[model samples]
Target: MTSLFQFTGSELEAIKLSVGVAIYSSLISLPIALLLGYWLARKQFPGKAIIESLIHLPLVMPPVTTGYILLLVLGTRGFIGQWLYSTFGIKLAFTFEAAIIASVVVSFPLIVRSIRTAIEMVDPGLEDASRILGVGRLKTFFQITVPLAAPGIISGTILAFARSLGEFGATITFAGNIAGETQTLPLAVFAYMQVPGREIETLRLVVISVLISFVAMALSELYIRKMKRS
Candidate 1:
C-alpha cells in the first residue's frame, strides 16, 4: 500500500493554503456578517429586500457566476482592483486575498443568517428599556444586544469558518488553484484525483476534511447548549 503511494509537495502546500485562506476568510467576513446581520435583524428601511437579496444571492447562484462577478470587480483591470494595485500595490485576483474574498462571499450567508436569528431572538423590550434609561444607540448595541447575541454570533462564525474551509468552486474559479499559492484542500484533493498514484493521499485529505467538519459541528452544538444552560 505504501509503495503505490506518493504524495507530492504540492498537496501539502494546498492544505496549507486552504487553512490560511479559511482563517483569513473567517476573520474578514465576521465583522461584515455581524453588521449586516444586526441591521437585518433590527432595522427596517426602504430597499431592504434588495439588500437582503443581494446578501443571500450567492447561496442560490452558481459559484462560477459569483467568482466571475468578483473577478470583474476585483480583477487587475477591474475598477477597484486597478485602483488598489496602483495605489497600494495590492492585487487581489488569483491570489490568497482573492481566495479569502471568494470564500467569505460564499460562506457569508450562513454567518449572517445565524447572527440575524440570534439578534432577533433578543428581546426588543430590553432595548426599549435601555433607551428609556437614555442609553445611546451605539452603547446599547455593544453593551446589551451584542452580549445577548454572543451565542448566536459565535455559532454563526464557527459555521462560517467551517464552510469557508471547504469552499471549492468559488475559490478555484477566482484563485486558479495554483499550488502553494491559491490551491486549497479541496483543490488538492481534486488535483490528486486527476492523476494516478495518489489515491491514498487523496483519501487522507478526505478523511481530514470530514473530521474537521464533524468537529466544527460538534463544537457549535456544545457552545449553543452551554449558552442555553447559562
Candidate 2:
C-alpha cells in the first residue's frame, strides 16, 4: 500500500476537489435544509407529501436516472440552462458547479430528514413559552429551537458532506470525468479502475475515501455525544 502522503498529483487534485465540492454542497444545502426541516416538523400544508417525496426521489431512484434528469434540466440546451447561459454566460453541465449541484441534490434528503428529526425532538412547550415571553417566532427559532437541535444539524451536515464526498454516478453523468476540473475522489477511483496495472492507485484512492467517510461519521457521533452530555 502506498503511504497516504505519497499521493500522485492527480490523486491529490481529486482529493482537493472532492473536499471542495463536498464543503460547498453541504454549506449550500444547510439553510434550505433548515427551513424545510423546520417547516416539515411544525407545519401542515397542502402538497406536503408531494414535496417530501420529490425531495427524496433521488434516494429511491437510480443515481444514474437522477443524473439524467439533472442533465435534461440543466444541460446546455435545457430550459434553465439555456437561459442561464444566454443571460449570464454560465454553463452548469459537465463542470465543477454541476458536480456540486449533483451532490446537493442527492444529499439533500438525508440532511432534511436528520434535521427534521432533531427539530421534532425539541419540546414545543419551550418554543411556546419563549413566544409567550415576548420572543418573536423567528427569534425563538434561532435561539431556543436551533440551539436545541444543534446536534442533529451538525450530524446532518457531516452526513451530507460524507455523501457528497462519495458521490459517483450523478457526478460522473452530469459533470463528466474531467480531471483537475470536475473529477473528484470517487471519479478518480472509477477512472483508475478502468486502466490495467493501476491497482495501487485505485486502492490508494479507495482507502482515502473510506478514511474520509469514517472520520466524518466518527466526529459526528463524538460531537453529538458531547453535546448530549453538556
Candidate 3:
C-alpha cells in the first residue's frame, strides 16, 4: 500500500500551507480569545449578550456568508481594502493572507468558547485574594489566572488550529483556490475530486485531513478532561 500512500508535490504543498495557516491563525486567535474569555467570565454589563452574539456570529452563520463579508470588507475594491491599497498598496482578497484571515475569523468563536468556559471555572476567590495581597492585575493574571486557565487555553488553541486545518467554504470563497498560494488540503481534495482517475489523490488528501483533525481533537479532548479533573 506504499503506492497508495504517496503524496504528489502539489498535495504536499497544500499540506504544508494548511499547517502553516493553522499555526498562524491559532497564534493570532489566542490573545484575543484570552481577553474576551476573561471578560465574558468575570464581567457583566448591559449589551454583554449582544457583544457575545456578535463575537460568536461566525459560528452560527454560514461559512460562505462569513467569507463574503470578509471579502466585502477586505477585497480590493472594498472601502477598507481601498484605503489599505491607497495607503499601503496592499490587497487581501484571494491571497495567502486572506486564507489566514478567513481561518482566524471562522475559528475565533470556538477558541473563545473554550477559553471562556475555562476561565469561568477558575475561582473568583483566587483573583480577589491576589488583589487583596496587593498584586497588580497584570501580574496576578499572568501568574495566577493564566496558570489555572492553561489547559483551556491549550485546548482552545488546538481546536482553533484544527478548525483552520479543515476550513473549506470560507477559505475557498475568500481566498480562492490558487495552488501553492491559497490552496489548502481541503481545497486540494476538492480540486482533485473534479478530475477523472484522481480518486487516489483525493482519497490521500482526505485521509491526511482526517488524521490531522483527529489528532487535534484528541489533544483538545485530553486537555478538557484534565481541566475538569483539576
Q: Could you say which candidate leads in lDDT?
A: 2
Which structure is stronger by TM-score: 1 or 2?
2
- Candidate 1 C-alpha lDDT tens digits along 1-230: 56323556776677678778777888888898888898999899999999889889999999888998888889888899889999999999998888999999999998999999999999999999999999998899889999999999989888888988898888888888788888889988898899898778788778777877788789989988898889
Give all TM-scores, in the order shown: 0.92, 0.97, 0.96
Per-residue lDDT tens digits for candidate 3, residues 1-230, read: 78678888999999999999999999999998999999999999999999999999999899999999998999988889989988998999999999999999999999999999989988989999999999999999999999998888998899899989989999999999999999999899999999999999998998889998998889778877887788
Q: lDDT score, residue 151, model 3? A: 88
CA lDDT of every candidate:
0.87, 0.95, 0.93
What candidate 3 gets wrong by more than 4 Å, as runs, is: 223-230
Which pairs of residues collide in model 3? none
After the best TM-score superposition of candidate 2, give how far the Cα of residue 113 lies from its true spot, in angstroms: 0.5
Q: Which regions of candidate 1 are displaced past 4 Å?
A: 1-9
lDDT of 2 by residue, 1-230 (tens): 33645889999999999999999999999999999999999998999999999988899988888888899999989899988999999999999999999999999999999999999999999999999999999999999999999999999999999999999999999999999999999999999999999888998989889999999999999999999999
Query: After best superposition, candidate 1 residue 223: deviation in angstroms?
Result: 0.7
Q: How does model 2 fare in lDDT?
A: 0.95
Q: For model 2, where is the 10-residue window of minimal lDDT?
A: 1-10
